[model samples]
Target: IGASAILAENAAILSSGGGDTIDLGFDLNLESPINPATVTDVSEDAIEGLKVVLAASEEAAAAAEASMPQELVDHLDELSVVALKNATNLITTSDDEVDIPPKPEVVPTIATITAPQQEQQSPQTLNADEVSLAPVAFDVDLSESSVKEKTLDEQTPSVRKILKFAIPAIGVWLCGPILSLIDTSAVGVLSGTVQQAALNPAVAVTDYAALLIAFLYTGTTNMVASAQQTDRGTKDMPRTAKMMIGAMRMSTYVGAGLGAFLFVFARPLLRGIIGNDAIGPAVFAAALKYVRIRALGMPAAAVLGSTQAACLGMQDIKSPLYVLGAAAIINFLGDMLFVGHSNPLIGGTAGAAWATVISQYAALAFFIRWLSDKATKTTNEDQPGVINLSDAILEMTSKSDKKDCNGKNRRQSFRNVMDTFKGKALDAKRKRSTLFQNKGVVQNIRESSFGKAIRRRKETTTKSSTDDDDSFSTRGFLKNRFTTRDLFKLPDAETREKFAPYVLPVTSTQVGRVSGYVAMAHVVASSLGTVSMAAQQVIVSIFYCLCPIADSLSLTAQSFVPAIAEKESSMEKSAAMKKMLVNFLKAGAIFGGAMMAAVCGIPMITGFFTPDQAVKELVNSVVPLLLVFFGVHGFVCGTEGMLLGQKDLGFLGKMYAAFFAAVPYIMLGVKRKALAGCKSAGLSSVWTVFIGYQLARCGLWLGRAAKLQRGTYIAAKEQESAAASATTNMSALLAP
Candidate 1:
């Protein structure tokens, strides 16, 4: 678990590389205090160069670590503790041979430390002047030659790219409510006869149930989105699809089981819940019937939702949009044909359900075809290979031997002779220490003290100093320390034959991307549910009608962020973020202002759609509030996209939950407490809370944006200054 945690952290840092270095404190027995000012050995250019390479290395290492089986990871954690102790002993001692230390028997607890206890045993601290420190940890070497540089402008995503993706996002968000509105319109136009009304009694409950089933797909979206952030593409998209399909199948069985129970006792349940209401029992029976049929579509709809999430994660929204648009049209026409311009009938409601069922199956078919093509492509890519432990040990031993040989050659060089021997003859030394004598000398040394010599070499090579040069060799060492190549190179089968047999399969995390269609549907449904599910649908449909424009702009925003993140180009990130925000806000403002104006100047603007006086009154009261929400809707959408990019779904979930819970409470309060409650207060208590909560959340999101922007600015400034300093230092070092 610790190893997994480390790998996750490393992945995040590498992906967000902006010239930061890993500050593992090894100088004090893995407890060294980080002194940023004191550590100045690396050149800014070299550090920055390493940042880019580290990004890939970190990703690879994370993949390798994630691939390890759970049991192996648990064992690895145990071995790592032993390794750390051995490493500490080697660093503290100065013998010429390697000595392995036993792992500590007792684990240290934070509460176990006291000031007096710590004071009794402390390493001498260098005050202001002393510099050198003993080696403490293994630093793998990765080749510096692997790093590459690219121009900010050339690599950054274009405005057009952002719009293309964002547009699809907007479409995904708006389509659900529009479809719902179409259903409502078609149903409302049907005959008002008593029998027809009875046939569609539980329209409200069944609609909510359908949406509840749809809500199950939100999890699919979040998972797929996270997968995409880590480079998992559409080829692996089906794994997510399959999982969702499984979940959907399970949900369908459950929904059907529940539906059956409800259908068997529909009359009694309806009476119990809505005792005095004349419409209750009939509605309950209709709801039970609707569920029995709709339950069959659940698994297919779930799979469709999963596929949509994966597509969205891949940033391909066009397919889902096309599929849903056609589905909506088909459903509308089906509704009209079954019970047009007259009383509702069982045939009409069933016809609508059947239309939806067919559409879901069609969408499922399309998703499967797309997934197959993606899988085929992924199968051909170069992927990580599995390695076992025995081979890894052999590789370590071989590398150590080569390193020892190189050290010997350097020590035997002319420069070393001049520094150590003065006028002593090299031939005399060779004669004094012959091959046979060397064997005798080597035999005298025990493994216990042998590690000291290795420690000396580590300290000499890794000690930080301001005057140090940036060498290709040093960069290579860093590369080897951090790269995926060093993750776990187990010994070959021949070597493993002598030790404990362990199995490890190389595999990355398999959390697949969410389906774009599912996510879109939820966003639309939830947004519509905000006001009153039905009214919410009507308003959202209107908003969706303007989606072509909103969607085009959103696509531009989505495409620009990934490149900006990769390049560590703050200026471009800021510019793109700002441009998207501004445009969205402007569009929202114009939209909200126009709608509000239309409501105020012409009250019938809302009344024309509904004859129910109460429904019209509710609409009149909430128009301004709804308009305001719409005006800022663009900003909300853009912010959500940003959140997606950051892989910060926890925050999104919290905010979403709060909004959902708060809105309904306010609406319910206002309806129950009419003029008397309002007369005591300046305005209706409900609307006040409603507007307040919306504005408050908007403020919170804005604050988040500001904090992120400030962080980006600071990072950019620091990197630039470091680069400048590196240039100056290098110029002086090369001066004759």
Candidate 2:
């Protein structure tokens, strides 16, 4: 329901009279002319044509299993070809720059003309006049309705709520960066310039290694959000709670696998990334040590990332802030104590790595306990364990009066209550018995997927069937321990098949991005030696720490777009969404402008990172280029956020996959300069290349956003105009 729901009411389509109506009927092909949203001077023939079209559309829509979100995202192109855009004419209209006509008046026709209840029945038996009446334009209540009864306001969040989610998210983004910045500052001042230079390669390997599997975080969130909305809009299976469990289990295994892979091949991976002679011996050794040690925390980091993503998808933002805030403090204190002139074995970069590892595991422990507690509470409420099924049934029968309750009504009510209870339970036994063995694949790929949306019950936890059941609390929960068995259960056959579409493209995209970036950073930073490497590290560190500002805004967009677009609006939903988007864009632009001044101020504090004049000058020289990069990235992140929220992941995946092409070209350029012993290629040109890439992304996303935004605006204007003129056209339309 969070994504998209059924529009409950049918809209009245008032005509201006004349519409450039092409032939519209049961059969319309590419060459057939379609009616535009606005019409004037309509003849009876056009009305007849429209009636046919409206009937066809309504029939298709009612029979369509595709929710509005499913229509917008899962079957966009297919809808265009068949003109099912009218299937959701209640919301937004599709087709390039087109508006939709309102559904016409309903009229009775012959028995033979009446449509059958089958999925794809046609009104072929109707006569000409009956043909027009055959396709009824009015609302037809069907037993298996695809859309939700909720309005746009009900389906999409308001700006205030989005900001509520956004503000807390900024802190969540900052926690990881704060740890890195601390390490950079402590290592630069305490361990000296050599160790600082080593950080560029060390961080590239360690951070990106975690990000390489970041699909688990991003993909899980997208799928969960979609599933949640679907559950709200339809009567289908509830998948959100199921997915929550599956995602945690799947992410842990994947994280552990990645950790093992990195630990075993740390040297070769680092070597391949930086090239054979990318950094000097001492720097390489330090980076390798850091990478190997950080690899140990990969599983915890991955699980934490996935856990946080699941919460975000559920629109719970405060939990991450609470958890990460405590983790950040732990990391800060650990860094201060462990780094700078500590035990020789634990000093410098190694100490920083150790500090981060400890904090990550701490955060992980808290999250696990928190999840287990929720299960314990939910389980206790849903079922009091001391009352066995047979005992409960016997007790219920004993309580019933023989004439009224025990005869029939009591048993029927009991069955009904039992079914609802089983549907809502969270324990392993219920999951094993009920959650698996889903029905066959759906025609809509979106429908085939499994999800787990827990609609939390308000039932009192203190209430239980028997006195013995009250004591069943602590000991009952301990059987599962810190982690729920629900999270350990692997995906069954149906799950693996359906879950692939949601996760595979995202993982592929992350793989291309992480590998390409790690390779590109190695090439660019290593070309100019230790001085350049150190300068690059400082610049990157500054950018990433501030990057959360732009990132949080992007995340806000991602969280809102799909569900809003799927909702019915007179442009209000889209307009509200657009307004929210503009606010964030403005925030990004203002933040970017301020950071330009911040870059200039960086020269004043250059001594904090390194005392070396060469490193300082190189960093200062690139401030102008860095300003361009910061400004360009603001728009880049916002537009990409729009696309991400649009669920255009398939296109995004291919776009980034193509982006890997630029890495090889940039690599060759750096290699040529290094071989020729030319120090002329500076960080300035590197920043320019990155700026160009940012511009390319902004341009692409901007065009796509513009097209989609225009479609929605036109849809809104037409809806308002049609509604406003209803009185004007009502007489003319109903004229005998």
Shift in Å, residue 602, candidate 2: 2.3
Which candidate achieves the best lDDT against the true structure? 2
lDDT of 1 by residue, 516-561 (tens): 1122223323222223434433443443455334433333343334
lDDT string, candidate 2, 1-736, tens digits: 0000001111111112222333322232212222222112345565456546545655555445344444343333433322332332322334532232322212211111222321112212222222111111222332211223223434454444445566677887887778777787778778887787677667777777776676677666766676677666343324765666677778777878888888888888778767667458888787777777788888778878877876777666767777788788888887888778556457788888888889998988777776556332434333211112222223232333333323444433433333333223223223322212221221233233332111122222222232224221111121233354555566566655545665656665666567456655766655666677778877777777667766775666665566676556465655655664565566567656766777778889888867899989988988887777677666666666777776677877887777777755775686577658876666766666666666777787778777767777888788778877996799789999
**What's the TM for model 2?**
0.59
Candidates' RMSD to native = 23.0, 21.3
- Per-residue lDDT, model 2, residue 219, is 63
Number of clashes recorded per candidate: 54, 23
Poorest lDDT segment (10 consecutive residues) of candidate 2: 1-10
TM-score of each: 0.46, 0.59
Cα-based lDDT for every prediction: 0.42, 0.59
